[model samples]
Target: MNSPAFRIRYGFEAPECEPQLESLLAHRSVRRYSDQPVLPSLETTLKAAAQSASTSSNLQMWSAIQIERGEKRDRIADLCAKQRQVQTAPLFFAFLADHYRLASLAPDRAERLEFTEFYTMAVVDAALAAERMVCAAELAGLGICYIGELRSHPEKVREELNLPRGTFGLFGLCLGYPDPSRPADIKPRLPMNSVFFSDVYDADRGIGDYDERLSQFYREQNMGDATWTQRIQDRLGGPDMGPRASQLEDLRRTGFAKK
Candidate 1:
């Protein structure tokens, strides 16, 4: 593979590209996979990369559960709204927004740590860890998909994972060697001007050309008939972004580090 010219035309257009930089730009989410399993060693490496992420106040409040059994993977896929990749991927990791570890460390003072359960900090911690796993896995030449739908039934998921109080499954990752019969590409992102602001927050810079560019990409990808704005509206359109809309409170009950 000589690498796609798409790499040359990146969001930053940074001519100074390394091998790793090239791979990152060409990132894609693989939904289909071969029967091959991700080895245990690779799993360990990915976990180490996730743990290496910096934390808020150095409170490392997150964890990953590797689901080993086939039956369990099937159940998880079903819970995630019958996403076939969940079951097909040889390795499934449940990423957690965990406060239990820290809470347990101070059993006597555990009542005080209960103050972290508010705001979006804990969510950020979990998201950061999840993203690290994604980067590490891709670097190792594997394909990955975030199973946010796993939150379809939070309490049920907790029970399935045998998670104790103060820990919650934020999302899941499905990983495997991709099946060549299927294909993937870097999902187009908003233009740099739309998301990357300079100096103060100037939202007026690039809001103009987003829909047309995004619609072109969407049509090419065949993800849907809607344009970028239309798709987004459909996403938050009605009440049902997904079946897991009820998960927020479940998160609190499962020890979300909320106050």
Candidate 2:
């Protein structure tokens, strides 16, 4: 059987690109999932893949909890802005920025963990691990969606998971066998030249071309057309980040982001 032809779904062709690399370009967020359950051994391998991600100086300041199906998952779904996928996906991983383990190892050096840089490292580490896991899952023909809404109610999430101090829920990942009946398209991204630059930064070029491309892509998906600039404006225009506006304070309360 012939492999599926790959193209830049944003309305361009990159036939010169190697076929193996093209699979990475074909990623799409799968919101709807079938009732199939991901096997326990597969999940173990996925976590191992995540753990293989690089960490800053090998600090490994990250952790994840696979929420089991039950009342806890239901509560967690509500905590994550009530995303139905969180409730129904075959697997859910609450990735955390964890400093607790390190602090516990050397309580005398705990003061060093209070710096903002440490907190940033933890968040970055968690993100790297999660993305690596996502890549592995996609390779295995599974679907995934990131739930950034897990940051909306940080304290509540801590309570739901019984998280200790020095651990913050960075985000959630929903994993499952995708429901083909409700397919999602590969969302367009900024063109390479616009994002990748040489030595010095060139701020002259704007995202006008990408905005137009994405606008057309949205229309093709039957969603109302809107420029990428407009979407960014809508998302970042105000300090009204709802419950997430208190993230700094929440992080502080969790023993991170301290002065």
What tens-digit string does per-residue lDDT give for candidate 1 at 1-259? 3345243233334445565566666668899988777788988898888888877887877778888758888888888888988888877889887777877788887665556553255667778887887888888888888998877788778778999887778788888888888877666566656778778999567555567666766677776656777876877877764556656567656655456
Q: Which numbered prediction scores highest in TM-score against the true structure?
A: 2
TM-score of each: 0.87, 0.94
Give lDDT per model, in order: 0.74, 0.87
Worst 10 residues of 1 by lDDT: 3-12
lDDT of 1 at 57: 80
After superposition, which runs of candidate 2 have C-alpha atoms over 4 Å from their true positions?
A: 1-6
Q: Taking the tens digit of each residue's C-alpha lDDT, what string does model 2 give over 144-202?
A: 99999999888888888899999999999999999989987877778777778899888
RMSD of each: 2.8, 2.1
